[model samples]
Target: MAAPTPRALRRGEISFKLDERTAHSSLDLFKKDTSVIYRIVGIDPTKVPQNIERFTDWAVVLGDTAVSSGRHYWEVTVKRSHQFRIGVADLDISREGCIGVDNHSWVFAYAHRMWSAMLANKTTPISNIGHPERVGVLLDYDSKKLSLVDVSKLELIHSIPAEFQGPVVPAFALWDGELLTHSGLDVPKKLSGN
Candidate 1:
């Protein structure tokens, strides 16, 4: 197969990065492999810290800012050895429960040899993906649409319409063997008419 062409961003595409302070206060629940990468090898019960609460599953982190209106885009590179979930969540999303099991987050996850989008207890399988190495997120708050792109192949993995009740922030979860690399952050382009 031929190499996939890089995708061109539409006007007004905005970007962001992870905010360490707001990254689920329990982020230390997992381990940070590098400055911008993390590994979730499961929390050690015996070593649990006093102030940090233990999560039954998954380690989550959020981006720096809460976006209420705009077209935002960001990309994360996952090593592909294990599963990962990436998307946006309402500012008040719970840090204790599984990310997508609640109403405040919308995430696209890859695990158990499959890709799926989850929102409020619903898991919708997105077929035909084979362990994407990098994922791109395109969030349109005005349209209430969130789309995930397979960056390596330049393919749209899934696009779901969501009701983002308020300001939303970029969030992600990591599992064993997953190394998340924050790829790029785009500045919101000025629109011609706006």
Candidate 2:
């Protein structure tokens, strides 16, 4: 194949062509080098320590397979560099556990679990947050991803994939919904409709 131009580069198409059964596109993060790149046609997307990049900036890889079965193609870029740092395979495509990240990486300021971003490199290694308190999950309608981040930092991270992912999200019509999350372990395992 040819070298990759930005999604907004060549033909105003924010997508690349790939075969799901053969080769797959992906995102590679080099925390040590401070760089992020799309491993597909070999394109660098983020500069080291670009302040705005996070785990969300990286593409969602299903297990060890790179290819995904879907229709759309897009990559994520950090707010600072504006480079397409993470080329997501097919976000809206769901494989298992809501497949692609469908919603926001939920956070509660009062219960800051995703605070690994605040660590000084030498002080504490940037590993997944280990919040021991929380409830409710984060859901994405587009990527079909659910992050159990509505309360505590979250733990025992595991992915449960499904052929037909869904309305895995619950509705919170009240402004005080998240506030009550601290009541603990009330997160619904099955999506609302289930």
Candidate 3:
């Protein structure tokens, strides 16, 4: 059997950008806030005001826009990062801990060359796929389904079904390296089934 080719199924795209206010002190936002790089030196706290929305202990950032309804899709290109988490989470998710360890978030994580799908402290190991350069996220708000795709290979990495409490935003966590986000993308036919 061969992998399916990626094709556009619908025209649902979103204006996704990282919310700098929510970024951790150790992370620096660049590329018009579409990309973030982790800095060991960290930013000077004196320059950046303390905000409750900021992630205090984790290198995490949330999307500026929240999705409450309809279908949406976006992509994240992993650049020089071996450990990272890409997914969606409610706005109220704990800013102190890692994502996917709380009920408000669902993530596809890659760390130490391992892949897993996580939710509420539960980790489901995913095997048989190689490292992906770009990961695509598909959120069907009406259906409450979140999917993670290995865009480089055009493979479905994982999917989660949940009863979202309210609006959710794209969330990312990076311990090392950098990430670039691409938004306003049409939901792929292979994943959207339209």
Question: Which one wins on TM-score?
Answer: 3
Instruction: Tell me model 3's lDDT, rounded to 2 decimals.
Output: 0.83
Look at candidate 1 and tell me the lDDT of residue 31: 34
User: Taking the tens digit of each residue's C-alpha lDDT, what string does model 3 give over 1-194?
Assistant: 43221122232577777888889998999999999999988898667768778898889998887787888889998888999999888878887987899999999899989989899989999887667777788888888888887786656767888679987888999989999999988877777572
Model 2 C-alpha lDDT per residue in residues 51-93, reported as the tens digit of each score: 2111223332211112222212222112222111011223223
Give the per-residue lDDT of model 1 (tens digit) for 68-173.
7877777766664566688888766665776777889999988898989999989999987777767778787888988887666555668878998988877777
Show pairs that collide, candidate 3: none
lDDT of 2: 0.25
Rank the models by lDDT, top first. 3, 1, 2
Root-mean-square deviation of every model: 9.6, 16.7, 8.4
Indicate the TM-score of model 3: 0.89
Instruction: Give the Å error, residue 3, model 2.
Output: 16
Compare the candidates by lDDT and give the number of the best one.
3
Off by over 4 Å in 3: 1-11
